[model samples]
Target: MGRRHYILPDCQIRPGDPTDHLDWIAADIIRRKPDVIVCIGDFFDFPSLSSYSTPGGVEKEGARIKADLDAGHAGLERLMAPIHAERERLRTGHRKRWEPRLIYTFGNHEERIDRPAKEDARFQGVLGTHLCEVERFGFERYEFLVPVEVDGVWYSHYWQSSHSPRPIGGTVDNRLNKLGFSFVAGHEQGLRYTNRPLPNGKTLHGLVAGSCYLVTEGYRGPQASNEWRGVVVLNDVRDGNMAIPMSLDLQYLCREYAGEELQAYMDKRYPDKDWSHLA
Candidate 1:
């Protein structure tokens, strides 16, 4: 039987951001019961350890590592709550448990924990990826930028160029041409997909989707914040091949699971801010 793969892009869960989207995703997962679920990384946005800004600078002020970790833990628990509840219900009723493989790739944001720690001996033991405790959540954790292949498809936070440390830049077609394989990744914001056919008629697919959360970053400003946000579902996947993928955008997920249109939900929940870009 063909397997279904659910790909959740970078949630970027951090302190002060709403995490109801995680619950929405969990509800959808409970209903779909996909064979495999992949979190394409950046589940935690460690702004406290962000390298983009100077440490102890104005941008880094008021950002606490503990607060950031706590938020991530809470968000992750919310994401798993519905699934855990469903599993418990199944066990009580003596039904087969719906257990899917959970895979999490570490993104550049998660790498923040290591960089400062590696440079300064004082942070060595205190600051580490182990603090997040992803393994406890039944997720197979991968290092930043490392690729993990499942069902013949390569999955990574983002695929880097063979010659450089930077990610393979340009269009999805460029990535497909460079990698020359079926792969799914998350890092760049928004969604970009392309496929190529082989001589033997098999096709290779490439997907790049990030930004799964409802909040927009100040850095993105108003215009750039309007990028696509949501999860992806791949059906009939085998041998690193896939049929056309399905996009489950935030609006669709919220409307179906939350029973409210995304705009209305945002307005009622976060009325103080302008969420026009998200519309």
Candidate 2:
């Protein structure tokens, strides 16, 4: 059997996304039982660092950063819990040889941690360095530019190789035409795919596996159709054969796929109110 990998890109965790979508995928991940799962990038949205955030000057910047970090941390735990459990169960019991791994790619937003250190000297080592530490999350981490390879496809935050002209941009078609290889990345929202036929009866593919979150910006156009929310799943991935991002309905998914009642977690916290619209 070929290796399977689930590509979840750009989950800009701040106010965060509903656990239901991730919960549902965790169930499927348990079943598909992929050898690797890639949380492709920008898992955290450091809103405080945005130029738009502090247009005039930095106000309560520390507080804003802390809040984003806190939410991001909590969101990370929720997203990783089921995958962690399944991975451990497989290694500890029935499948001793199976070594399932969780891979997290640091996108530009997550890189917001570095800017503080770059600008200030005394505060360089003081804070915003947690991106370097991934042990708690049980994930193998990669920087924004470092590409992680699966069976064949490469996962990176963005694609603009020095070998190429300049930057062909982040669109799937642009990447496929420029790099002549399969790639999956985030930073740009919305699901886009490009498939090219090879001479060997094989199909090469590239995917812009978009973001999953509730936050929307006015800058992303009034309708915001350019952005998308979902995860990409690749089964038997080899030589770039890929799956398009499947738009998710976390509520419906949790109801149908989640092995455990996600509502149980919500019920205790929010005794009243239907949280079907979470994220």
Candidate 3:
């Protein structure tokens, strides 16, 4: 009857603790039971098998990488199992009213999967399997970005602009005020929204869905202090209106489960000397 609320969770997975943040987020999503779930990308840390290698460029010789990948898969399954189960649980009764959907978009890390070489095979295989699983659950997948309409508002993962300045402006007011559509996007890993006055005496609204996982320890330099993660809830968008402030909360779900061992390992592998200032 009105704008449907969509729950978007960002960067659900990474090479972190054995606990797996996806499992936690999945459980939380099922409990909250939103109309749809969208993943902003980087759902998997190293989307390509080639990325897992020693500094000498030697790949993991045997089952070491596979084992780790398998472990990651198992963790994802554990997290998604409930979502799949709940879909079935809800489908049996109100097949028409409750057809939950899952949507995924590619992130920079995942782009590595499409890189040149046989090593990318692992990434292709893993993502292919994930796509199939998502389809089985009646979810849709978009490439880098796709436009969506909610309550007459248009949304996309990336926005186009002629200005040569920063790609993303913190406020929606400057981005979509005159575009005549409400917009939502994710990739910046921070929650932001802006409402700007239009020439027609109305206002334009924009929203940025934030991340839900921990900031990778490999990050250093000026950007080292800018780490944050969280999930977003689009309360109302179907009634031709934008949700005020665009609900979001910062929670260290992944960091909490990462455990000290993993953190130490990451710190050792990617020393602060190699950290970068950009996210």
Give candidate 2's error at residue 5 in angstroms: 0.9
List pairs with backbone clashes in candidate 3: 3-238, 151-238, 211-230
Tens digit of per-residue lDDT, candidate 1, span 52-130: 8897889788999899999988988999878878888998999987888999899988888888689999988888888
lDDT of 3 by residue, 101-146 (tens): 5666555444444453334555555444343234443456665554
Q: Which tens-of-lDDT digit does each residue in 1-279 have in candidate 2?
A: 566787777777764334445656667667666788788778787777775565545542454677877778877777668777866787788685545677888888887887788789866776554643665887887876788888778888877667763335755676787778777777777777778888987777888765775444545655553355666677677656755434443334555674435455455555664434332
Residue clash pairs of candidate 2: none
TM-score of each: 0.96, 0.78, 0.65
Candidate 3: stretches off by over 4 Å: 16-20, 47-76, 92-97, 117-133, 160-172, 177-180, 197-203, 221-226, 245-279
Better of 1 and 2 by lDDT: 1
Candidate 1 residue 222 C-alpha distance from true site, Å: 1.6
Residue pairs with backbone overlap in model 1? 152-240
Candidates sorted on lDDT, descending: 1, 2, 3
185 Cα displacement, candidate 3 (Å)? 1.6
